[model samples]
Target: MNGRRTIGFLLLIGLVLWGCSGVHPTSNAVWIAQPEFSEVDNRLYSARIAPQKGESPYFSFFLLTLTNKSSVDLVVDWNASQYLFNGKPQGVMVFEGIDPEAVKNAMVPLDTVAPGASFSLEIMPMRLIAWSPIKEKTAAARSISPGMLPIGENGILLALRHGNGHITIPLSVRISREGLP
Candidate 1:
């Protein structure tokens, strides 16, 4: 009788732990959906071909959606990065110590997103040309060498840092064979 009781107790504990991971069941306020390669917008987010003046290029535009989840107002710092499925890091994007003017342009910050409520920022697309020379140099340093394939696209992981921990979001990128202008 005791042996059966122990097995049942273990199973109950496992179920509770699994439920607490708190991952959203759907792409709602609790969860953010990662963009996939086939996901369409004319702008090529990661491309190899040098952009012409009129070409539609894509760059990292910060989009923040904050949900307090807890009963109390949550004030937290946010950060993001990209990586491959095998745990190899592709790139990291951080906002720490960045100039206020630049962040103001890239992000839409909220003093308080409010409990159980969310705030979002749909940033304007940025072009590759706007990145600093240092950014370009770093891209070259990576063995992959930042270049978008006409068809090949990769998935990236995004990390949002807050309160000594983080929530990660996944994203994917693909370049169209069809040229953009």
Candidate 2:
């Protein structure tokens, strides 16, 4: 009986530890359902953005997938990419040398997406001073500048120039103390 109790206690402790690891086993990671798609110059472009695993409040990272559904190839200029917060443009943050392997793999080489193919990339926007819902509510109380508040109902806009046209996708991200989903 004592041995069985010990085993049960150990199993309970193991379960607790797994839950605290942040990486939920059951796909608990938040994700966006409907990706934004637009047609420009007879080419279809779709984009999906989501928070990186174990995202931080100080600096948030996002995973992006750009798909090309048209018969023609498309090129994306990463240098010209912009992130708009609440209809206002914010500074773009470059990962530089600290980029992880997964992030590197996600980066589009030459910013090109072949016909009927897709490119995965990682984008880190400017420093988000108030990402958590609780922090958002207490931002004024904490004296954080209003401009630094996280993008809310206005939604985040990702604009990328492709060839002679441009593709703008609006992403509605829900951020909480836990993380963006």
Candidate 3:
């Protein structure tokens, strides 16, 4: 009985530790691109790109900060915005809206930026997930060869639509393994 009790205790402890070791996705990834600030229509816009924590290597997050300098509310259509990665256009994924709690503070609501206020927009790339064997085969057939992109030397472009016009910001990211730029 004593030996059985000790074994059960050790098993419980192991299970607890294993559960704790599971990765909980966070937004604390290394910023590959420094924040780039731009001023348009008296409003300030800043953008940056970073790899999301606990996600695939290709998965990234584009963060946008918009500050309303004008005395009037600024309307932004985040859903209609576009992102270009190294000249390749990418579609925005709607995962955040599907599971808001999973993303935590990383999820940003699309709404009006009140006068003298600011708002953030987080964007993720669309990824195709195969659910069935046939779908898996189809996806594999259509998938392009996986390759490593030199993110350090690539350029990222973000086009965000505002009330009247759109703001285009180009981010030139230079990264080094030794340190961040």
Candidate 4:
């Protein structure tokens, strides 16, 4: 069963790495990452990030669980939030059910979290999942090829708004690929 699932996953992820940031075209490649929320130290909010259930560990989409710790309602400004790769902005993040056209055109949505409340969802970088002027349409981790993304810091910088101010939450990620045949 596991072998069948892996084969299916590889067959589904037909994206060629090409010239992604960390990958070399003519070699065996493997993507490595470790995603967690413990490093984010902020007064306004806290968050946890992880891969989705039954998904590939090849750095595709994942779950984001954000908690509001402030006294005021916190807004997840999707328009302002960004995906970071190698410590740079890749693009805005997007969730399931979001219109691909909106992602292409940068039309994003915002979510509000009441004080002490939590907001949870699965998400990935729109640039990694949607059609764009600079990028062709790709699904899930198809664009995140091994060797394309250099082995370094990569993650999301969440934009949170509260009352008249805002705070940025950084969820750093590192992933690994081992035991694959």
Sort every candidate by lDDT, greatest first: 4, 2, 3, 1
For all predictions, the C-alpha RMSD in Å is 21.2, 13.7, 12.5, 11.4
In candidate 4 the C-alpha lDDT for residue 4 amounts to 100
Best by TM-score: 4
Candidates 1 and 2 compared by lDDT, better number: 2
- Model 3, residue 18: what's the lDDT? 79
Tens digits of per-residue lDDT for model 2 on 1-181?
9999999999999999987988643244333222222222334777766655343332155566778877676676544455555556654433323233333354533467888888776555534422333445452443211122243422346555555777666654544333444
User: Can you write out model 3's per-residue Cα lDDT over 43-138, one digit (the tens) per residue?
Assistant: 354344543323334334444566776666566544544445555545433333334332234343456777678776544444322223334445
Clash pairs, candidate 2, are: 106-120
- TM-score for each predicted model, relative to the true structure: 0.33, 0.47, 0.44, 0.64
TM-score of 3: 0.44
**lDDT tens digits by residue: candidate 1, 91-176:** 43332233335444545342444556554432222211133444444533421112221223434354444344554545454333
Error of 4 at 146 (Å): 15
| Candidate 1 local Cα displacement, residue 63, angstroms | 4.6
Model 1: which residue pairs collide? 47-148, 48-148
Residue range 1-181, candidate 4, lDDT tens digits: 9999998887666544333456433234355556443245478777777653233335566578888888989888887888787778887877755665666676666789999998898777766553343364466433322212234566778887889987787776765555444
Residue 80 miss distance in model 2 (angstroms): 2.5
Ten residues in sequence with the least summed lDDT for candidate 4 = 141-150
Error of 1 at 91 (Å): 2.6
Best by lDDT: 4
